[model samples]
Target: MNVRGVIAGLLFLPITILLSIAVCLARPFSRLAWPSKVMQLWANSVFWMSGIKLQVVGEEHLTAGKPAIYMANHASMIDIPILVAVLPGHVRFLFKHTLMYVPFLGQAMMLLGMIPINRTNRTKSVESLRKAGERIRSGIDVIIFPEGTRTKTGEMLPFKNGGFLMAIQEGFDIVPVTIHNSREVCGRNSIVTRKGVCRVTIHPRYETTGFTVADRRQIMSDVERIIGSAVQLRGRDNAAPVIELGHH
Candidate 1:
């Protein structure tokens, strides 16, 4: 690790803790806004510390004052901050249930209405999705990593069905965001940081209002293509060609 990187991480610790506290305290009244704000702050701090800048495109594609299911490919851990900082609307993220057990921050995330999934159990995963659907129906935008986990080799992974299922069930529009250059900045499974510019391209939102279970597979396929095309258009040399969900 670079000396500067270690120093930056140390500086980030207190800010992260303070924001965590704010989220925990603000939970009682309404969780619809505070979590988003806290996430935005966290993103800003990370961007500043890592010397990473962002360029957001297609802002017009997002609808204001309406809930959406924001889906994106997982490239790096920094992708979270990039999305939170650049995406147009407020978002609540779907995270692993294990995260809710992390000291003070875990408690804060639980209090602030973040959806927690028990990836080990199918029954619990379904229950988590149902609860997420309810939250979207009630007008809170949700961010889900359809790939379910980060790409190990910078290639898109097989997308899980949970996000699209919830979108169809709740009649929410799906905003497909393509993040570029994040993998190079932090890469997958590595902590060595570098300074670089990241870009988030927001494609036209696809509405799920009239979709049904029969259309689920097709919907996921189309989104995969959209994100793949966006990545290629942005000149990512190794961008993966969109593939059928179960093929790879």
Candidate 2:
């Protein structure tokens, strides 16, 4: 672990927590139009503190006020902040149910309208996803990690069907996103940070309104291919070696 990275973490961690508390307190009366702004401020702080930088491509692909399912491959914990910081629109994240019980932050998450799923129980997971879809239909865009969990190796994982299913059921478009170099910066299961650049590419939306249950597998497969191709292209363009850094 880099000693400077450690120092940066120590310095930024408390400030992040304090900001989270402030955001939590503001969640009760009205929607935090600036939640993403707060998140961007935090992400920029973390980046500056850790000596990491972000280069985003395809900003023109994102349309304002349009609710679409933003699906991305998970590489590192940093992915969340990066997405929250760069992705436009109000994003309601679909996270594990366990996150909803994490002290003060959890209460704030609930108030902010994050959907939590009990993945252990299939029935409950589906129900939770349905509710999430409803929220999307009601005007909030949802961000989901179709890979379901972070990859330790940085390789793309087999995307779960849940995200696509919700898109099909709710008549929403799927915006495939590829995040590059996060694993190299901060690999899964390690706290150490490496100086590097993380790139996020937002592909144009793939419509799902006409798809049916029989097309579920195909939809997921297509999403996987889109992400894989985007990642590969970014690596080639950046002159980085192509390796599956995601954990199996």
Candidate 3:
């Protein structure tokens, strides 16, 4: 284990625990306002302790008070904190159901109103997706990593289609977000963080207002293409984006 990473982890553990407890306790009164700020502070502490730098683009695509599904490619664990810090408003995660039972974190997530996607079986998964739809309809934006889990090889994984199914069914818009070089900071199956820059590009929103289930695969494929084009899986570069859009 790297001494620097271990030290960073030790420093952040107590802060994390305290912040989680604070969220669980304060959420009932403040709803999401205070808890959201605490989440940002917790995320900022992680980046500061690990010496992680972030460069973001296309934030203008997100509009205030508009509920949408923010879909992104999952490359590393750092992607979670990055979204929590960078994205505006009260954005909740679409995490796996098992995470909802993880001690303090579980209680905090429950109080903070983060929806859990139960992927145990088809019947249960559909029910969970319906629950997510209710959250979106309530005027809260949800950030979903289309690739259900972090990529083990830094390569983009095939999306699980649950987010898309929810989007089309509920007539919510979809925003494609691309994150590059996140793996260099904290890769899968590792808690160690390396000093590196993570580039994020939030693409224009993809509308799903009148989409049918038949159009799900096409929409999914398009989002996958948009996010995958920005990063190189094999040749990792943690400085700047190699593929730049018109303005970025």
Model 1 stretches astray by more than 4 angstroms = 1-4, 101-108, 190-192, 233-248
**Lowest lDDT block of 10, candidate 2:** 239-248
lDDT of 1: 0.76
Candidate models: Cα lDDT each: 0.76, 0.75, 0.78
Error of 1 at 2 (Å): 6.0
Ranking by lDDT: 3, 1, 2
Q: What is the TM-score of each candidate against the true structure?
A: 0.85, 0.85, 0.87
Q: Give the higher-TM-score candidate: 2 or 3.
A: 3
Flag regions of model 2 displaced more than 4 Å.
1-4, 11-13, 99-112, 234-248
Model 1 over residues 70-150: C-alpha lDDT tens digits? 998888877777777777556777987886777665765665577898778999999999888787777777889888888
Candidate 3 clash pair list: none
Model 3, residue 196: distance off in Å is 0.9
Which TM-score value belongs to model 2? 0.85
Q: Report the number of the highest-lDDT candidate.
A: 3
**For candidate 2, lDDT tens digit of each residue in 1-248?**
56655666565546566767766676664464656556656666666667766767777889877789999988886777678767766787887788677655466556556788887899999998988878777777889998888886667877888888888877789999999888888767444577777888888889988899789999998889988887755544454322212110
Candidate 1: residue pairs that collide: none
- Evaluated at residue 2, the lDDT of candidate 2 is 64
